[model samples]
Structure formats: C-alpha cells, structure tokens
Target: MKKLALAALVAVVPFAQAFDDKDEAIAYRQSVFSLVATHFGEMGAMVKGDKAFDAAAFQYRADSLAALSKMPLEGFLYPGADQGDTKAKAAVWENTDEFKKRLAKFQSDAADLAKSAQSGDLGSIKPAFMKAAKNCKACHSDFKNR
Candidate 1:
C-alpha cells in the first residue's frame, strides 16, 4: 500500500504546481513539504539503523525526494504564499535571490542523493543523504519560522 501511494505521488509530482490563489499556494507548498519530510525521515531511519535498510526502498525514497525537491519553490513563487497559515518566514519572499540559491542547492543535493542511492551501497548513500539533509536545515533556519 505504501509503495502504491508513493508510486502515485511520483506519477503526479511532475504536474504539481501552486495555484494562483494565495491560500491554495500555501496549502500546496505545505503539502509538498510534508511529503518531503515523510520521505526524508523514512530514509533517515534506514540510514541510522532504526529501520532495516532496504536498498530498493531507500532508492525509491531518494528518488521521490529528488522529485519533491523541485516542487515547493514554485509554490513560493506565487504572491502572498508566505502569508497566511504557513511557517515560511518573510525572508522567503524578502531575500528572493538567497532563497532561490538555497532551493537550488537542495534540488541538486536531492538529485545527488538519488544517484548515490542507485548504487545500493550505504557507504555511497550516506554522504549524499547528509548533504541533502543539510539543505533542509539551512532553508528552515533562513526561511522558515519555528
């Protein structure tokens, strides 16, 4: 069931976008972030030995994160997306160039993680995953409110 749901998400991710409505944009980004957290956490469990490492599953999650990494940025592009029920700080919209740079780094890191996961070797995947994970912390520190 989980695999089926993830497969559905992978299929839909390329078409996902923020709506023109401010509320909808907020919802879109939040939903994307939620999915990102879910997948990232799942990978973390495998990486940290909390969960049995399934190479195939790890690769799938890494690939999903790579796809998801491309989504939230579009949601932030819509006006008023930083307002309303969101944890995104004003700096997301205020420091546009920096925000974009961080997001681009995240996207690149995610892709690298996915590529590393393809080897089905934990040694290869760990550093890539750490790099990708750092982007999350960096972005949250600079752009998201606690």
Candidate 2:
C-alpha cells in the first residue's frame, strides 16, 4: 500500500509542479528568431536598394537587431527544447562547444554592426552588415534548416 501511494504521489507531482516546458521554450525561441528575421529584412531592404536608405532608421533597426541578438541563444539552452515550427538542429543542444564558438562570433559580429550603424556611413554599415549577416547565415546553415 505504501509503495502504491508513493507511486501515485510521484505521478501527480509532475503535473502539479511548475516546470520549464520544452514546448514553451521552443515557442519562445521561435518568436525571438522571428523578430530577428523581421529586423534582418528591414536592414536588407535598405542595403539592397529595395527601399530608401534612411540612416537613422537603419541605425535604429540595426541596434534593435543587435539588442535582440543576445536573446535567441538563451532559448536554446535547454536540452530537448524541440517544439513548434522550428528549423533548429539537435546539434544546437548536443554539440554545445562548437555552438558556443559560433554564438560568440555572432555576438561579436552584431556588436560590430551596431557600432557601424551609429557611424551613419553607408560604406561602413554595408561591410559591417555583410559580416554580421554572414555570421547569422553560417549559424543557420549549421544548426537550422535551409
């Protein structure tokens, strides 16, 4: 009887406890990545001449992207955080050492982009954007679906 009661309690405890659900974590990360894409698109439109190059707006958008850059990695910290519409590969959680190095490069690239964005020089911003965008693409290529 005691063993039965303990088993029942263990089963019920999981339901009662507030836990960091992997589904929710994946959803949150997806939302953040969506934001990153939006900002990336905005910058691309300007850089590619699809829209007028508004330096101030570009700076603001670039800065926003840089600030948001630090967020998506946090969402990937949990193991087995797979759910929602995702392109993330298992290596994001499994091969963590390589992922960390890639993440550091991304962060560095974003910082450079942000600094160049403030210069209001299209040439500077262009090179910086190229580097930052490349870093983003490289990570996606390795850890996300094409």
Candidate 3:
C-alpha cells in the first residue's frame, strides 16, 4: 500500500518536478549557446585587431562554432511547458514567427563565419567574424536575458 501511494504521488507530480522536457531543452540550448558565444567573442577579438590573429586558436574556435551550428534545430523548439530559467520572455512564444526568423539569422551568420574561417584567409575572416558578432548581438539584445 505504501509503495502504491508513493507511485501515485510521483505520477501526479508536475513534469517540472523532475526534468521537464521544456526545461531540459532550454538548458541544453543555453549550454551550447554559451559555448558558441564564448568562442565567437574570442574569434572576434582576434579578428578585430584587439588580439593577434592566432591561426590555431581561430581554427579551433571556428571548428567549434561549425559543429555547434549543426546541432538539431529541435533543440530550439520549446513547447511552452515548464519555464526553468525563464529568461526567455513570454514574447518569444507570442512572437513565435519572428523568434524563429532571428534564430535562422543566427544560424546563417554562424555558417558564414565557418566558411570564411575555412578559407584560411585572415582578411576574409575579419569581416565575416564581425558580421557574425552583429547577428549574435542583435538577437541577444532583443530576446535574451540582460
């Protein structure tokens, strides 16, 4: 009887009480996003003349960005379930179409950066890196936590 009662309680508990699908997806996306942002920023510094352009470092970061970009788009799909970090505003769901557009822009910019980096030309990389940074900034400014 005790075991039955415990099982019943567990079943009745909200998804958020465990690892809700929505929260899990959000966390996963954020983790990957952080890595993408960090490497992009470092690459930006190198390209912008703030730091010497180190070929090995740039290649490493660019590789990371390219790999991260290839992650399934499903990770970005939020079902409006549990709000874990909840840094994502209600506006995201309300303006679903626009949010998706912004995400596409980010992906496109990252792709451009990846291609430029592969060219092994510092001059080409500098502008492409800057464009990628701008895309990241635009999305974060409008959609992300301050």
Candidate 4:
C-alpha cells in the first residue's frame, strides 16, 4: 500500500525526470516497461498453466505489475521523447490525449488484476489477468513498433 506507492515514486522519479535529452526519457520509459514485462510475463506463465500457480508468487507479481503500471508515463512527458532510439510510435506524441487514455486504462486494468490476484483463487484471477493482458496488447498495437 503506502510502501508500494513510495517505492514506485522513488524508483520512477529519478529516471523519469524532465529530460534534458530525449534519449534519457526513452531509456527511462524502456526501463520501466522492461520491469513491467518481467512481472507480466511471470504472471502470464502461471495464468497459462505453463508454470505451477503459486498463490503468493502470483500475488507478488500482480502487486509489482500494478505499481510498475504507474511509472512509465512520466518518461513520455518530455519534448521529443517520441523521437529517439525507441519503439514508441509517433502517435504516442502526436495523439497525446488518446495515448494517455489508453495508459489510464492500462493502469486501471492492472489495478483490477492486482485486486483479483489478492484473492488467491485462480478462477477469480484468470478473468482479471486476461483483461489486463488485453489492455497491454491494445496499447502496444497502437503505440509501439515491432
């Protein structure tokens, strides 16, 4: 709760600074998403039955993902952040309001998944996980390059 929020803020603030260089901003967001991907992938494995579902582990990953979901947007705020050695589509900057709406959805979806995972029932967890995963895919399709 408080600790998780504090940790997220601490971890994000330095990297997601008002960037003097666009590359730094790109790197910051990439770093945040890398962590997001790690947690999301582990949770996916459990959700897909590729890994044994450990309730505690699943909950931990979900919490981590929820916290991580809050960090990346700051990195995208700087000027020219979209023009860099990065995979972000120009639409991310050009269509800022829509991109932000998608991100807000992602944050809400991740929070819902975290809430579901906290219940420790695979049956309850699955739908929430799928919803969050779907949000991720949608954002990527619109805003990221292959």
In angstroms, give how far residue 55 of model 4 lies from its true place: 0.8
RMSD of each: 5.8, 11.9, 10.9, 3.8
The digit string of per-residue lDDT tens for model 1 on 58-123 reads 999999999999888878887777779998899988899999999899999999999999999998
Q: How many backbone clashes does candidate 2 have?
A: 0
Put the candidates in lDDT order, highest first. Answer: 4, 1, 2, 3
Cα TM-score of candidate 1:
0.87
Q: Which runs in model 2 stand beyond 4 Å of their true positions?
A: 1-19, 83-85
User: Candidate 3's residue-wise lDDT over 89-123, tens digit each?
Assistant: 66666677887887777778777887788777899
Candidate 1: residue 136 Cα off by (Å): 1.1
Better of 2 and 3 by TM-score: 2
- Judge candidate 1 against the unseen true structure and give its global Cα lDDT, from 0 to 1: 0.90
lDDT tens digits by residue: candidate 2, 63-119: 888778766766776556754557888777678899889888877887888899888
Q: State every prediction's TM-score relative to the real structure.
A: 0.87, 0.81, 0.74, 0.87
lDDT of each: 0.90, 0.81, 0.74, 0.91
Model 2 error, position 112 (Å):
0.7
Candidate 1 — which residues are off by over 4 angstroms?
A: 1-20
- Top candidate on TM-score is 4
